[model samples]
Target: MFRSVLVANRGEIACRIFRTARRMGLRTIAVYSEADANALHVREADEAVLIGPAPARESYLDQARVLTAAKATGAEAIHPGYGFLSENAEFAEAVMAAGLTWIGAPPASIRAMGLKDAAKSLMVEAGVPVTPGYMGKDQSPERLKAEADAIGYPVLIKAVAGGGGKGMRRVDEASAFLDALASCQREAASSFGDDRVLIEKYILSPRHIEVQVFGDAHGEVVHLFERDCSLQRRHQKVIEEAPAPGMDEATRQAVTAAAVRAARAVNYVGAGTIEFIADGTEGLRADRIWFMEMNTRLQVEHPVTEMITGQDLVEWQLRVAAGEPLPLKQDQLSIAGWAMEARLYAEDPANGFLPSIGRLDHFVLPDDIRVDTGVEAGGEVSQFYDPMIAKLIVHEETREAAAQALADACADIEVWPVRTNAGFLVRCLEHQRFAAGDVDTGLIGAEEAALTDARPSDAVIQDASDLLWRSRNVDPNDVWDAEYGAPGFRLNAARVTRQTFFVDGVRHQAPYENNHPVVRYGPQIDGGFVVFHGGDAYAVSRHAPRGAGGGGASDGSLRAPMPGKIVAAPARSGDAVTKGQPIVVLEAMKMEHALVAPFDGVVGEIGVSVGDQVAADAVLAVVASTS
Candidate 1:
């Protein structure tokens, strides 16, 4: 094995690779951007290097800086964990050419599987079933439209180089195909620098099932069972589990066999995943599953695979990179128990799942089970990268038990100020259809309202007064605290010491009394305490809106929800606007959030001009009600 290894990625995946590298007695080097100077991965590395500034392109994706860092730290190998340059075939070749072991798929294999169109063609040649679609060189809109029409309605327009739900669109009718195709192509070009797209027959009930295939230098490959990534939001995976809920032995064998074939077709080595899209209208069947694309690096949800198989996949990667034989034969692996993982992100589901960035003042996660993260309390979730905070994973003998246990764990999360989708995850886990093995990609969108309900219950809000009262009157050092109705003690509320506060800018009041424990909240900060309950943060403050509010109020004001640059201001001060009409585009965290009109009104103000930088709550534009 290589003496030292440098991880050319950031966040949880980088930290995860380091854990295994340390266990294998290898020196670990980490590269960080300016924003990630205090990041957990940098702090935990044996040696760290400053690659560039906060932006990813200047740091994580900077090939020259990464190579220089590795050479300086005497790192014998480079591990591109996932994302960023993980799938960049040229980067892989550069690492190899620089005489460093690239602990990932070879450049040849990466190139072979880089484009979805090419990969599908290879899969077909390898006798692996592929989705019925068009993957031709014709870039004309007419050809794409013709392909869509032939494939029937509800065709999937996918960018050849897309991942993480980007550059993808589903058209349910012929009329929308052209528009969807145009949008998909534009995103693909902007995101991957490749506008080429392929059309596929959209599955009515699609379930993402992928097999973990590891190949060794000895030309041997083995499968580590399969994972069901059907539970998704906006094409991004929300929850993933091992031993797909409805998978039978026959289907597993067929899928795993095809996965091995897919890997072997490209002479693939190291850790790779063969993603298959299954039509789960009925239970999983071999005939219903087809190859989608291949992920040529370790996956974020690899923990669940480890929990079930009792194998260290990172170690496998290290050995393979060192030109070792397969760790175990195909027959040696067996699925043990059900494992489920939920990606906990710093985002507000109710508000279009926009990224939430701020200091994690009171971030706390459950101790039991497995929790993987690269951020901690007191750390700032900067608007320079992805906002995934952690991954909550659980393993149980039964799938039912795993889902419930993971749901409870999600409910136990306590974060303040910065909002999250923890409550949404809980609902997803406990959803009747989800619990019954009726999983699909449309589950989140179909049940978005119930899942993303951000409102705190009447009882929870009623108990907020108790939290505020304790924050003011109760002493932390007092061991002899009053219990419910114990010697002049009162439960819920004894005296109506009315306390007024605005939660998310809306005002509410409740009687002050001791309602211990049910309503948990962080200590007083920025005017008032933030109620942390059921994995949701309700910003409660005694003060009301000051002047022209910006932090996204129900008013017709369009504000920079977070610190960002104004990209476009389409609506003028005198322009008439309707509710939800796009007025301003605020760019932050590598995402563009459209600040839309809150209600039907006339545009009364345009606060920020294009190319202007603004603060978290800075007003961008405003649309006043006609009344």
Candidate 2:
């Protein structure tokens, strides 16, 4: 085994790898950006090094800086923990050239599967069932239009070079294809530096299932079962579970076999994931499943697989990277239980899932479940990176039990200051269709409103009111005439204090009690400040609200959701735009966001041009009210 390994990444994933490395008796080195100087990963590592500035391009993405960190730290191997430069073949090659072991797939394997168009072509040739689409090298607009026409409407335009739903668009009709193609191309260029795209038949209601595979240097490969990642939004997975629900023995065998084949075809080593889009409309079937893509590094949702497999995937990656043979064959691997993982993101799900940035004051996950997180309380969530807070994972003997457990755990999770999708995740898990195992990629989108619509019960509102009354004075026994000296409170001997505070979009009138030594609103609010108001009270620390500016809002225009560069503005001043019409496309955290017209009107002013970096709530444009 390698004596030491350098992790070329930051956040929870780096910490995750370090834990396994330490357990396996290997020294671990952690590299971090300036933003992550005091991050958990750095504190957990045996050694730490500063890479560069906060921006990924200047730091984590800097290959030379990572190599220098590895060399200076005296690490024998480098582990690219997902994201940043994990899948970049150039970085993998550089690691090997630096005379250090690359704790991941071979550089050649990464290169082979780096490009989506190229990977799909290879999979098709290898006899893996690929989605029927145009995967040709032709980049002509006319040719793509022709392919879309030939394949019929509702085609998908995907970037050839990157994944994570970046540079991807779904057009339901042929009339919308051209505009979507240009938009996708621009997003592709902005995100991956590659504008090349490929048209594919858009699969409706597909369940994303990926099988994890591991290989060793000695050519021994084995499958580690599969994970169901059907719940998603904007093509990004929100929830994932292992031992896919309702999967039969035959289909399981076929999917696992195809995944193994894909792994061996690339002469892959270490850990990799073979994603397949399964037809959920008619339920899952071996024949209806098609190859999606192969993630050449440890996946973000690997915890679910670990929960079910009872094995450390990171440890295996280290062993394989150290030129060890497979520890067990495929036959030895068996799913022990159902495990579900919910990605907790710092974003507003109701407001088009816009990323939110702030200090996490109250960060608490359930003790009963396993939570893999990168951020801690008081940590600032910057706008420069992905707004993921943590991942909550739970394991149970049955799928129903696991789903319920996850829902309960999510409800118990208290994260304040930054809005999260925890409530949304709980609703999804409790959703009837999801509970029944009838899920698809469109599940979240289809039930977007209900999933995000979090409302405090009457009991909760009552509890808040009681808390408000009690917090009026430091001395609970103070009379109504007595000075109720406290912030957000005043001595109101003549009248009840009425305040309007939002809880899960529900406006509540919390009438403070005028005289009450014993505070009570909700039955459970006897001792604490409103027992379940929104997320968690301990998680609620007040901070200055983000300033709203940007765009042109003289007549009240909707602003940009978060900080990002304007990649596309199809509308200009005086152009008529209807509600929901695409006005501007903002690229942030390596994801494209479409700012649609709030109401039917003519574009009064366009404040930003392409390539403009905007701050959160910065108005990009204003629309004159047509009504």
Pick out the ten consecutive residues of candidate 2 with the lowest summed lDDT: 536-545
lDDT of model 2, residue 308: 93
Taking all chains together, the TM-score of candidate 1 against the true structure is: 0.90
What is the lDDT, from 0 to 100, of the residue 491 in candidate 1?
A: 58
State the lDDT of candidate 2 residue by residue for 1-627, as single tens digits: 779988888887887888888888888888888988878888888889998998889999899999988888888999999888889888888999989998888888998998888898889888899988887878899999999999987888888886888788888888899998998898788667789998888888788999999999898889999999989887888999999887899999999999989998999999999999888878889999999889999999999999999988988888888887877887888889899999988887766687888887667777767888778888878888888878889999999999988888877766655778877887898899999888998888888888877655556565555565555444434344343323334456544345554443234675555433221222222223223433423211112123323334445485877777888888889898888888888888777788877778899778999989898879788888788
lDDT of 1 by residue, 282-337 (tens): 77989999999999988999999999999999999999999999889988989899
User: Against the hidden true structure, what lDDT does model 1 obtain?
Assistant: 0.86
lDDT of 2 at 96: 91
Error of 2 at 310 (Å): 1.0
lDDT of all predictions: 0.86, 0.80
